[model samples]
Target: MKNYFYFLFFFLIPFGCDNTKGNKLVEKSTNDSSSIYLDKAQKKNIKQSEKLKYYKKSFSILKNQTNDSITRSKLFELTKELYKNNFSEDFLESANLLTTLSTKAKDSFYLAQIHRSKGNYYKNLPNYDSSFIHYTEAEKILKKIKNNDGLSLVLINRSLIQFDTGDYTGADKALNSAYLISKKNNEIASLYAISVMMGLTSMETKDFDKAIKYFNNGLEIIKNNNNLLGEFNKETCLNNIGLSYQKKEDYKKSIDFFKTALKNKSIKSEDPELYSLLIDNLGYSYLKTGNLDEALKLFLESLKIREELKYYNLIVLSKVHLSEYYRQIKDTSNAKKEITEALFIAKKKKTHRDYIAALKQASIIDVQNASTYSKEYIRLSDSIRNVEILSQEKFARIQLETDEIIKEKDILEDKNRSLLYTFIGVVFLLSMLFVVRAQRARTKELMFKQAQQRANEEIYNLLMAQQDVIDQSREIEKKKIARDLHDGILSRMFGARLNLDSINHLDDPESVKKRLEYLNELKEIEQDIREISHDLSREKQDLINNFVSITTNLFEEQTATHSAKLTYFMDSSIKWDLVKNNIKINVFRILQEGLQNINKYAKANTITVNFRKENNELHISIEDDGIGFDVSKKSKGIGMQNMISRAIDCNGKLDINSSKENGTKITLNIPLE
Candidate 1:
C-alpha cells in the first residue's frame, strides 16, 4: 500500500525540469571529460562496477566545477534518473552533489527536488527518521515556492512513512492535509492516492465504517475520472470496501463486492497482486458463509499467483488462508501441513499478521502443540503491540517538534499584530477626543439657537396679542360710526320727512312743486346714510374673524423676505375658533420654524406650505426643491429639532424626508379633537 502511493507520486508529480535545455547543454559538453564518462556509463555493454565508477567520475568532475544553470540542470536530471532506476548508492552521491550545486546557484526548485529524492532513498532504505527529516526539508522548500502539487505529493509520501510505523492517527492527519491540497489544486491523481491511503489507515485503526467511506470516496473520484488508471483503481477501491464489510462480519455483502471487482477483465492480467487479494477476500467471505468448495478453490488459485509472483508477504497470507480452509473442512492433517508451510514462510519473511494467523490455525488444528502455539502467539502479539506504541511515540515527537517551530512563527506574527493594533487603538482614541470636543462646541451652538428660538416665540406671541388689541379697537370704532349714522342721523331724517309732509297739505301750486323737490332730495340723503351704517356693521364682523387674515399676512411676509418663491394654503374648514390657543400657537410656530429652515439651508428656488383638515386632524406639509440632506443621518443643527419640539407640544407627529438632489418634505399632523 505504501509502495502504491510512493510509485503514484513519481508517476503523477515527476520533478519539473527543462530537459530541452539540459539536453542541449549535454550536446555542447560532449567533449568534456565528465560528459564523456557519463555517456560511456550509459552504454548497454558496460559492467555494473565500471558504470558506477564512470558515474562517480562524471559527478566528481562536475562537483569541482563552477556551478551554473547548465550544471544544476544536468545534476538534477542525473540524480532523478538514478533514483528512478533504484541506483541507491549512485543516486545518493549525485543527489548530494546536486544539492550543493543548487544551493550555490540559489535554485530552490532543484533543491526541493533533491531533498524529495533523498527522502525516497532513505524511505527505501527503511530509515524512517532520516526519511522524515528529508521530507520535512523538501516540504518547507515546496511551501516557500508555493508548489501546491509538489507539496501534496510530499505529504502523501510522509503519510506512508507514518502509516508504515503504525501511527494511523498521524498518517490520517497528513493524508487529510494532502487531500485538501489536491482538492484545491484539482490534482486528480493525488486525490485518488490520498483517499485510498486514508482508507487503508482507517482499516489499520479498526475504524471499518470510516475505511469504507474513504474507499467509496476513492470510487467516486475514479468514477468521475474515467481512464485506464481509474478503471484499474476501481477494483482496488471495491476490494477495500469489501474488506471493510468483511471486518464488520457482513460476509454476504462483502462477497458481492469482491465478485463485482473480479468482473473487471484486465484485473488478473494487469494487476495480479490486486486480483489475488480480491480472490483471497472473496474466498474468506465464502468460507464464512459456508461455501467451502468455492472457498478452497479460490484459496488455491490465489496462493498459486502469489507464489508465482514471489510476493512472500502475500504468499504467507495465501498459505494461512489455505490452512484455514483445510481446517474448516476438518482435514486436520492437511491443515497442519499447510499451517507448517505458512509459519515457515511467515517467519522467514517476518510477516507478523500471517505468522499469527498460521499460529492460531495450528493451535486449532493440532491439539498436541496447541499450548505451545498459543503461548508464542500471545508473546508475539504483545511484542507487536509494544512496537506499535513506540512507533506512535516517535511520530508524536516528530509532530511536536514541527508544531513548536510553527508555534514560534505564530508568536512572532501575533506580536506584530499586537503592535499594529496598538497603533490603530491610539489613533482611534485621538479621533474620539477630537470628536468629543467638537460635539461639546456643537452643543453650545444648539443651546444658543434654542434660546434665540424661545425669544422669537415670545416676541411672536406679543405681536399676536398686540394685533388682537388693534382688531378690537377697529371693531369699537366701526360700531360707534354705525350707531351715530343709524341712531342720530336716521332719526333726524325721519323727523324732517314728517315735518315736510305736514307743510305739503297747505301748499299752493308753485309752493307745492318746490316742497316736493326738497322732499325727494332729503329722502335720497337718508338712503345714503343708512347704507353707510350697514357697511360699518359688516366690517365689524370681519374684524372678529381675523386669524385667517393674520396667517395670510405671515405668508406674505415670507414671500417678501426670502429669494425663494413661496406658496401657502390654509384649510378654511380648520375652524380656528374651536382650536385651543396653545395648539394654534405651537402649530404656527412649528410652521414658522420649518419655513425658516428652508430659507436658511434649503437653497431652494420654490417653497410650498400647505395645511389641510382631515378626519378631525390638521395636517401641515412644507416642501422645498433643494439640495436635500439625508434625513436618516443625525443633524447637529437645532432648527429641525425646534420644529419637532413644537409639533410634539401640539400633540402632533412630524416627519421629514430628504435625499441628495431629490428635495425635502416636512409633514406634521395634529389632532383637532
Candidate 2:
C-alpha cells in the first residue's frame, strides 16, 4: 500500500517544465533522421494544443516504423502521456494504433506497457476493481519479459486501489514488494515514497510509534533529495503524527505538529484535499484542548471548503466537529441541530466514523438525551470495529495463502536443484528407496490415523443430526400439548359452562341460588379457557414457523391483554431452507422470552416486527416502540442468551440496537446455502 501511494505521489506531480505554459522543450534525437522528423512533427502538433492531430501524425509515422520495437514503444508512451493529460479520445486512438503496431512487431514489452497505461487511466477514475484487472493483465506480460521495474510499479498502483477500498493488508504487501524492488534498483525517491505509505498504514492501524518511525525515515530521505513534493508528503506525515497523538490524548504535542503541518506552503499549493484534511485535524486538536471558539472557527472554514468541493466525507467530519463544539459550549439547541445534520450527512455518505463521531458528540448534551445518543454511538462503533476486524482477518488469510504458494515454489526449486546434481542422483534414489521402505513399515500407523479422523467426523455428523431430530421432536411436542389444552380441556370447560347455565334456568329458589353460584364459577372458568386457548393457538403455532412471528404475536397478545398497541410486519419471502429446526426453535424461544421481558419491564407501548431478505440472506428484525433498556450496562437475560445461541446454531448474525427512548431493533441474518 505504501509503495502504491508513493507511485501515485510521484506520478501525479507534473514532471519536467509546465507544458501548459508553452515552454519550448528539447526532444531527444536519435541517429535515425526519419524518427527525428516524426518527433518534430509530433512536438509541433502538441505545442499547437492539437493532441488528436499529434497522435494521428505519430501513429502514421509509427505504422511505417513498426519494424523497430523502440519506435513502437515510444508511440505507446506518447499515447499513455496523452491519456494522462485527459485527451482520452485521442489517447484511445493512439493506444489502438500502438496495440496493432506492437502485435505486428511482436513486442510484448510495448503491449504490457499499453495495458499498464490503461490500468492507470482506470485507476485515476477510481475504478479500483477494473484497474486491478488491467494491472494483473499487464503483470502477466511484464513477468514473462522479466521487466521487474514495470511489474513493481503496476503492483504498487494495484495496491493503492486496494488501500482505497479498505484492503490495508493487501496494500501493505504490495508496498513491501515494491520497496524490495526499489531497494534493489537503488531508486531513492521511490524508496522514500514507500516509507511514507508504510507510515500512513501504521497510522491507520493506530500504531503511532511505528508510524512515526516510518515518517521520520521518509522525511530524512526527502531532506537528502531536496524534493519539494516529498516535503508536501512530509506535511501529511506530520498531520498523521498529530492525529496519532490526539488519539492518545497527548494534546500538546498533537497541536504542535498540527501547527507545523499547517505551515507547509508546498502542501497548501499542491493538494487542496490534504490542506482541508490538515485544517480538520487542527480543529479536532483545538476541540480536544477545550478551545471551542477556535475549533468552531476552523471547523466552519473547513466545512465551507468541503461543501464547495462536494467532498462528502470531509463535510461530515467538519459537521461532526462543529456539533462537538456546540455541545461543549452547552448550546443544547444548536448542538442538537448540528448533530442531527451531521448524522444525516454521515448516513448519506455512508461513513461509519462520521456517524459514530456525531453520535458521540450528541450523547454529551444532556443526561436524558445522552443515554439515547450514547447507545447509538456504541452500536455504530461496534459495527465499524467489526468491519475493520473482518478486513484484517481477510488480509491475514490472503497472506497465509501467499506464503503457502511461496513455500511450495521453494520446495519445487529444491527438488529441481537436487535433480541437477547427476553424481548425487544415484545416492538420492537409494535414500528415497530406504525412506519408502520405512514409510511402508508405518503404513499400519497411518491407517489408524485415518480411521481416527473418520471416526471423529462421523461423531460430529451424528451429533448434529441428533440435535436436529431433538429440535423437531420438541416442536412437535409443543404443538401436541397446545392442541390438547385448546381442544380437550377447553371443550370440557365449555360443556361444564353449558350445564351450569341450564341449572341456573331452573325455578326452585334455594336450588336457584346454588345454581347461580355455580354459574358464576363457570363464567370464571370460561374466561380462563378463552385466555389459555388463545395462547395455545396462534402464538404456539407461530413459534413453530417463524421466529419473528412468534415474538410479534406474543407482543400483540400482551398488548391486547394489557391494552397496548403493538404493530409488526413479517416478510413472507424469507428463506428457511438453510436454517436448521434447532435454530428455529431457539429463535422462537428467544422471542418468547424477549416479549415476556418487555411485558415485565418495559412500561411503554407499540412493538414492531420487520423481516426482509437481502443479498441472498434472510433478516429477521424485531423492534418495539417501548421503553428500551441499556444493553451495555445491563447483563443479558437467559432469554437474550437463548437468542444469541440460536443465531450461532444457524451460523447466523444478530444485532440488538436499543436505548432509553429509541426502541430495540433485533436483526438476525441467516445465510442460505
Candidate 3:
C-alpha cells in the first residue's frame, strides 16, 4: 500500500499599526468603531458570524472615511484580513475584491500579494486549476521584483497544490526551489513553512527518517522566531514529528513528542483547534503505547474542546479516534455511539476522511454494517483516485494561462488594435485547447477501459496456467511417493520374504538356526513397516511436501530463469503447517510477480529474498541491486498490480521502497494468525 500524506497550511500576514500621518486618522476611525470587539479573544470565543459583524461594521466605517486610493487600498487590505479571519467561508468574494483594489492602486507588490491570497483561497476550496493560476501570477511578479520571501511563499504554496494533484516529483522540485530561496534570504518564517511542507512530501512517499529530519529542522526554526504564529507552528511541527515517529513504529518517541507539544502555552490556552489536535495526537500515542486510561482521558478532553468550539470538522476527527479507543476495550455500545456520530457528521459535511474512518471501524465492530460501509468506502476511494490522477496537467495548463493573461494585460492595456488581435488569438487558442483536452480525457477513459479488458483476459490466462502448475506439483509428489515405496520399503519386504521361504526348506538341525535367522529377518521387516507408516502419516508435516517446499520450488525456477544472482534465506522457526494453504499460495504468487517485475524493469545483477517470523507476523522481503525508479509514479504493469492485490488478499501490508540508490526493496508482512 502507498502512504498518502495530506497537509493543511496556515498562511499569516503580519498586521500592526502603521503610525504614518494619514494612517493615524484611518486607524483611529477604524479602531474607534467596533474593531476592539474583534480582538483575538472575541475572535476565538464568539461565533464566526458575530466576529464578521464587528469586522463588517469596522469596514463600513473605514470605507466612508477614505476615498484616497492609498487609504482605500489599505482599507481593502484590512477588509480582506477581516474576511480571512471571520468570513473565509466566502473566500472568492474577498479575493475578487482584493484583486480589483490592487489593480486600481497600480502596485505590483499589492498585486502579487492579492494573487497569492487568491491562490490560497482556491487551494482552501481545493480547486487546483484556479489555485495554480493565482500562484503562478504571484510567482511572476515576485520573481520580477526579486522578492525572495514572496517567491518562497508562492513556490511552497504551488508545491502543495502539486502534491494534492499527485504530481509528487513536481511537488518535490518546487519545494527544493523554495527551500533554496528561503535559506538564501534567511527568512525564518518561510523556512519554517517550507521545511514542514518538505517533511509532509517526504512523509507522503513514506520516507520517515527524512520526514523526521525536516520536521525537526522546521521546529528548530520555529524556536528562532518565538511569536504567536511561530508558537502555533511549533506545536504543529512537533505533532508532525510525532507522526513520523509513529509511522516508524516508535510509539514511545511519538508519545514523548505529543506530550511535549501539549506543554506549549499558546496551543493549550489560545488555539483551541491546535490544543484539541495535540490532545487527540497524545491520545493516539497513549493508545498505541497501551496506556488505555490516559488515552481515553485525552480523547474525551479533545472531544470536549472540539464540541465547545463547535468545530464540527474536528469533532468528527476526535470521535473517530474515540470510536477506535472504545472498540479496543470491547465497549461496543460506546464504540457504536462514537462511530455513529462520526458517520453522521461525515455525511452531513461530505468529509471523506471522517467517512473512511467510520467505515473502517464499522468493519470491526458492526458486522452487519461492514459490507455496506466497505462498498461505499471503495466507491469513494475510486472517485478520489480519478480526481487525483486527472487534476495536475489540467491545472498546469491553467497556470500557464494565468501567466500569459497577466503579461498580455500589462501590454494590452496601452494598445487598441494589438489588443483586439491578441484577444482573438487567445480565444481561438483557448477553444482549441479545450477541444484537445476533452479529446485527451476521452482517449484516457478509452485506454483505461481497454486496460481493464486486458486485465480480465490475463486473469483468465493465469487461472488456466494455475491448473497446470497445480497438476504438475501433484504429479511430482505422487512420483516421489511411488519411488520411495518401490526402491526402499517394498524391496526390503521382498528380500525378507525370500529369506523366510529359504528357512522352511532347511533340515531339522539347520532348520532351528535358520528359523532364528528368519525371525530376525521378520523383525527387520516389521521395523521397516513402522518406518513406512510414519513416513505416510499426515500428523507430522513433511517439509519436502509442504507449502514452503512448493514456494521454494518457485524460487528455484526464478533463479534458474534469470541472470540475476539470486539468494534466498529463511528462518528455521516458521511452522509452515500453521499457515493457511490459500495464504501460502498468495505469498508464492506475490513473490513470482515481484520477480517478474524485477526481470522486466529492474536492471540489476543481484537479488536477495529474505523471510522471517517476528511477533505474530510473517515478513517476506525482496531486494534488488538495480537502477530503481520513482515509486511515487503509479505502476504501469499488470503484474505489479496483481502482486498488490495478492498481498492485500493475504491479509498483508506491502511496502515497495525504491529510489535511485541501493535499488528497490519490496516487503510484505502477513499476520500469522
Q: What's each prediction's TM-score?
A: 0.54, 0.49, 0.49
- The residue ranges of model 3 lying beyond 4 angstroms of the native Cα positions read 1-11, 14-110, 124-128, 163-168, 227-229, 400-673
Winning candidate number (lDDT): 1
Q: State in Å the error of residue 149, model 2.
A: 2.7
How many pairs of residues collide in each model? 0, 1, 0
**Candidate 3 C-alpha lDDT tens digits along 247-322:** 8889999888878877767666777777777778778888988899999999899889878988777788778788
Give Cα-based local distance difference scores for all models.
0.77, 0.66, 0.71
Clashes of 1: 0
lDDT of 2 by residue, 277-323 (tens): 77777888888888877888888877887788887767766776776
Candidate 2, position 82, lDDT: 70
TM-score of 3: 0.49
Candidate 2, lDDT over the whole model = 0.66
